[model samples]
Structure formats: C-alpha cells, structure tokens
Target: MSVRPPGECTAPDRRCILVIATVASFLTPFMSSSINIALPVIGAEFATDAVLLGWIQTAYLLASAICLVPFGRLADIHGMKKIFLTGITIFTLSTLLCGLSPTVNALIALRMVQGVGTAMIAVTAVAVLTAVFPAGERGRVLGINVAAVYTGLSMGPFLGGVLTQHLGWRSIFLVTVPLGLIAVALTLRARGEWSTPRDERFDLIGSVVYGTTLLALMYGLTLLPEATGFGLIAVGVVGIFLFLWQESHTESPVLQVRLFFENHVFTFSNIAALINYSATFAVSFLLSLYLQYNRGLDPQAAGLILLAQPVVQALISPAAGRLSDRVEPRIVSSVGMTLSAAGLALLTVLTEETPVPYILISLVVLGTGYALFSSPNTNAIMSSVEKRYYGVASATLATSRQVGMMLSMGIVMMIFSVVIGRVAITPAEHAPLLSSINLAFMLFAALCVVGIFFSLARGRVREDPHRA
Candidate 1:
C-alpha cells in the first residue's frame, strides 16, 4: 500500500477515515471515563480497597502504554486498516469478557487485554487521519476528532452514571459492545489501507526491553514508599537507558529515538502532553469518590456534576484546533496550560465544606484549559513529523498520554497507600481520603504550572518544518 499524498486523496475518502477515527476515538475514552464513575460501585461489589480499585484503571493504562509503540511500528510495516480491524475485534471481545468478569482480579486482567486492543486503535486512528488530510486541513480534522474524544468524555460520566446507577456497573461496559460493532462495520466498508514504503525487520529485543522497563517503572510507582518499589524503579530507569542504547544499534527500532533529540516541537509538545494529562487525568477519579463518599451524592447526580469539564472541552476543542492553524500553537497551548494550573490550584482547597458551585466553576476552568491545550498540541505534534513517521508519531502521542495517565494514577495510588492505606472508603476513612485528594490536587497544580513552560518551549510549529 503506497501512501497517498494529502492533496491526492478524495474528499469522500477523507470523510470515511474521519468517521472511523472519530468512532474509535470516542469508544476508548468513553470506556475509560465511564469506568471512573463506576469505580466506587465496583469496589463495593468486590469488597476491595482503594489501592486495588486504582489498579482497575492503572492496569489498563500500563498495558496500553506498553503495547502502543510496538504495535504502531507493526502498523507502519504492515497496514493501518488491517491492524485497526484486528484491534476493534480484540477490544469488542475483551469488553464483553470484562462485563462478565466475576471477580475484580478477572476484570483487571481483562482490562489489560482491552488496553492492548486500545493501543492498536490509538496508534492508527490519528495516523490514518493525518495520512489522508493535508497539513493545512490537519488541525481542523484533528480538532473534530479531538472534539469527538471530549464528547465521549462528557457522555461517559452522565451515561456511565445512568447505566451504573440503574443497570449496574456491568452495563457500562456492555453498552459499548454495540458501538464497537458499528465501528467495525464502518471500517470494513472503507477502501484501501496505508503503510510505510520501507521494509525493515522489527526490533524484537528493543520491544521487550521497552515493555519490561515501562511495566517495572509504572508498577513500582504504585508500590511507592516501599524499598522494593524504589529498587524496581531504579531497575526500570536503568533498563530504559539500556533500551534506548539498544534502539540506536538495532536495524529497525520500535521507537525512533532521534525524534526527541532532533525535533524541539515534537519533544516539548510531548512533554507538555505528559504534564497536562498527569495533572488532569485523575481529576475525575478523585472527584467521583469525593462526590459519592464525601458529598453523599448518587452516581447519577455526581456524574452530572462531573460533566462540566469535558463538556467545555468538547465545545472549545475544534475552535482551538482551527486557531492553532493561524496562530502559534505554543502561545495558545501555553495560555491553556496556565488555565489548567489555575483550575487545579482551585481544587487544592477543596474540603467537605466546599460548595458544589465552586467545584463546578473550577471544573469549567480546567476544561477550558484542557480544550485549548489538547488539540493545538496534537496539531503541533502531527504536523511536525513527516508522513512516513505518522504511525510512530501518533503512537508516541498516545504513549505519552497512557504513561501520563499511569503516572497520574500512580500518584493517587501512592498517596492512597500512604494517607488512606489499604482501606475501604468507609466513613471512618473519609478524613484521610479528603486529605489525600487535596494533597494530590496540590501536586497536580504545581505540575501544570511547570508544563506551561514546556508548552511554550515547543517553539513555533509552522516555522520548524524540519521533516514536514
């Protein structure tokens, strides 16, 4: 499958790709955010503690982060549509199995498989979009795709809450099955596939080292305050360095290491994404518990309250993405990061006495910042790379997100281990839980403040067309 230049592709072809990408984009985030609303119910049903409950999300993120790059490279070597179809099948089946999981352990395991499926879809969806659309129109389509993501996020809490409240937590996972089938049906009808022209051997050794090290690092983060955790983190860090060195020597690497050192826009944009997601990803997770346990709200009401952020994001993303095409992405994204810092800072003061309106106000601020940051930053990343590297670039973007989400959860898990310990969210543990949530928000605010610098440091995307 030789690649088609952006100008050469037909409008209908672009529309088909966008439809597939949009559905895929919506599906994964919907599952993730909806599950956040169901965590309390899941914990209650299974009689699990906070740390174990965190694993429900963390395990999926870890698996997706581990597989994204390898599967992305495979897509580059083979075909995006083939991998995309396979992923949809895997995701649909795994999601079905997840709903049937009788134990928390079984559910967690299935989520890992679901994550693997997610990795394939995550890597290809954006790459395919970038592949079909011209650079001038990239941000517009990317914004639309990103808006779809926010739509899923916005719906996740409300729909997830309704399903969880009325139909049980299992319904939240089961409902996605029909949507998955629809995506598969649409994708199968799409014509042609995309792949890199170059033929290179896959680097088996680098993939193993990369996967192993990341697993160790993320798992270690969850086990924090323990000497074993520190030891494993040290090993993971060292192993990553070794993996990079191996990539430099390998004939064909899973990750193209040179992209980071050579491309300022790519590197800093990715860094900004890491920091932004790290600061913001766990906001819903913490608040879901806070609303249910601390504020004594039902899942339905809590979800409506939680919908403020992503709704703002869904509304603003396309405009911001289009704006980035005209202005400097760094400037627009930096301002967004600043807003995020402000939002997270507001949440740091949250307590049982805090008003619901205050929380909603803070969420609106955070969502605005996220809306500004995500689309333009993504536009910068995809635009900075050449067509041949789209799969890798897309996967790198998704990997940054998964790793950031994993770290966000890791931060929460470590805090839980230390502040709340391995305890259920009984009224007895409420005080400690509040303390933990407040402290986490404080750290996240500080992190977002730092991310503003990186967002600016990514420089101008339009000027630095090094490869694009």
Candidate 2:
C-alpha cells in the first residue's frame, strides 16, 4: 500500500478512502433501519413489549448520538484513520455479540456498544473525506457519499427481511461482519497522518451531563403514554434543565451553544434537518409495523414495499447536492421540503384497502422530497462553518438527525397508543388504525411545513476562496 501525505492524497489514494468512508457510512443506516423489518420476529423470540422493542432501536440511536461529538473530538486529537479502524473493529466484535445475545436486554446492551463504534466512524468519515478531496471537487464527492447512505437505507429493510425470513434474526448482525472487515482493510490502505492536532481538552463533564440528559429525555418520552401521574413529566423537565445548565457553563461544550446564536444558517439548517428527519423516521418505523401487523404482509413483502422511499432518495440525492453548489441552497431546500410536506399530506388518506401502487407512489414522492432537501441542507451546514470546525459541524448535523428520529419514534408511539385506547378495537382493525395513521402523517406534514420555513432561511455562502 502506498502512503500519502495528510490532506494531499494521490487520486487513487483519495478514491480508496472515499470508498471506505462510503461503505462505513452505509453500515450506519443499514444498522439503523434494517432491524425494523425484523423487530416483530425478534419480539416474538424474546417475548418483548413495544416499549422494550423500542429500546432495541433507542439504545443504538442514543448511544450513537451521545458519542458523536466526543468521538469527533477524539478523532481530531488522534488520527482519523487510526480511530476509524479501531471503531470498525469494535463494531465488528459488537455485531458478533449481538448475534449471540440470548435475551432482549443483552441484545440492547450489545447494540449500544455497536452504536459507539458507529458514531466513531460516522463522526470522522466526513472530516476524512473533506480532508482527502480538494475544495472545488468536494461537493461532487460528498454528493456520492450521500447517495451511498440513501442506498444503504433503501436496501436495509429488504436485506434484513430476507435474512430474517430465510436464516434467522441473528443473521442480520452476523452478515455485517464481512462488511466491517472490508471497511477495516480499506481504512488501513488509506491511512495517513493528521494535519493538525489541537491541544484543547475533551469536555468529559459536559459529555456525561449531555448523555445523561438525552437518555432521560428520550426515556421519559418513550414512557409518557404508559406512565401516569407527574413522575414522567418531572423527570423530563429536570433532565432538560440539567442539560441546559451543564452546556451553558462548560468550557469546551460538547454541543456548541454559541453556534446557535452566531450563525443563522447553521441554526436554521439544523432545525430543518430535525423536522425533515422526524417525518421520515415515522414513515420508516410505523409503515413496517402497519404492513406486517395490519395488512398481514410478510417481512419480505413489507420490506419490498418500503423500498419506494429510499430508492427515490438514492436516485435524487447526488443530483440535488450538485445543484446546491450552483444555485442558492435556501431555494432548493425549501422547494424540496414543500414537496415532502405535500407527499406526507397525501399519506393521510391511506387505508388498508388502498392499492400498493398508490402507497408506493406516495412514498416515492416523499423520498424524492427528502433527497432534494437532505443534500442541500447538509451542504449548507457543512459550508457555513470554518474549515477548522468541520468535525464539530458534521457531528452537530448528525446529532440533529438523531434527536429528530428519536423524537419521531416516541411521539408516534404515544399517538398510536392513545388512539388505540380511545377506540374499542385492535390496531389490526383497518378503519380506526388508518385514522390514527392519517393523523400521524398529518402531524408529520405540519413538521415539514416548519422545515420549509427553516430551509428558506439558509442564507447563501460563496464557495471557498482558496479552492483550486
């Protein structure tokens, strides 16, 4: 393997690293949504409840979110390639543990460990890519990375379903091992030194406080529907306050508080990402459940049907990213969000009797909108900050996505539970369940409207002055 200087790789060297980053990023989404198709099967095997099942996902998400900032900091301190390789190794080991887990609790614990590895890779992947590519060509390269992510997300359900149905749920975790090994090999081949290392200290206290707060908040939200009395609300309020106070005083805050005030583009872009992801999260999580339980579709069929959104997103993200480089991101993102809102609003009318083609069309529209919005919004966020802060900026963007997805799952579950309680029927009852599903979709559509406003506020930033 040929070694390249930091920030000055040969074409083949850069391409190699880019491929590795793309594959690593792909694993994150694959882990995220692949489990959804297998959730019911896993639940049956483990005799788990909805709340417990939710943790299977929440554990991974919360772990990944909590670790992203700190891991980014670590990457900056150490080397990106070194940290990335270590992360991939750990991720592979964790996947083995997950496959061998004998109980739901054990699986959740292993999933949390897997999430830490995922975060390490995710937080560093973009920074590595940015470092490898020249500024002028970065947009096109990053666009390809975005495309890979959507492709992974799109294929996850189908892959998971096929493995679960044919082999077993354990195969979902087992299959990732080979991919992780490939990522590690590529990472080693792409190794290079760090260009700069700051002497700044890691905010250990801030990380602990932030992690605790997010855990409490997500846990409280997850339990809100089932928890009676004032206990749940009290916990959530306390957690929020604690998080705020800790972040306010920390010298090196994990989440940069000042960024929210300093840059309108960053703030608005993050808000748009939050809302947009929340909408997509609901569709991914709930639709699988709806198809499997209500429509009595097998996991494979459900996964196939769910492919509409991701397939559309994969096709459009690269083009949208490239477009944002020429035109104003604000206009492009706003139009995309508006389209997403419209598509979700259309979902409000879906029923069990609705034809599969209609459902696929609606999802395709939603995916197209998401693809258009995601790349531009991400480009805006990444470009808004100084080059030195790229790692933190990427971590912040990812955290916004995680928070949105977590909130979406919690809120939707609460709505579904309340809707079920109010009616005298099971969720399998198509009419009443359809009404609840419509209500959720409408709520998501309203969120997209908010995202549109935020997207409109992302002011234009010119390309880098130092670019070749």
Q: Which ranges in model 1 have alpha carbons more than 4 Å from their true place?
A: 1-18, 132-144, 188-191, 194-198, 383-391, 462-467
Model 1: per-residue lDDT, tens digit, 1-468?
A: 356444465788778778889999999999999999999999999988999999999989989989988888888777688889999889999999999999999999999999999999988888788777888988789878877887888899999999999999999889899989888998888766644434768888988998999888887877888998999899999998999899888778888888888899999999999999999999999999999988888899999999999889988887998899898888999999999999999999888989999999999999999989998998899889887776677778888988899899989998999888887778888899999999999999999989999999888888887647
Residue 221 CA displacement from its true place in model 2, Å = 0.8
By lDDT, the best candidate is 1
CA lDDT for candidate 2: 0.79
lDDT for each candidate structure? 0.89, 0.79
RMSD of each: 2.7, 3.8
Give one clash count per candidate, in the order shown: 0, 0
TM-score of each: 0.92, 0.88
Give the clash count for model 1: 0
lDDT of 2 at 95: 90
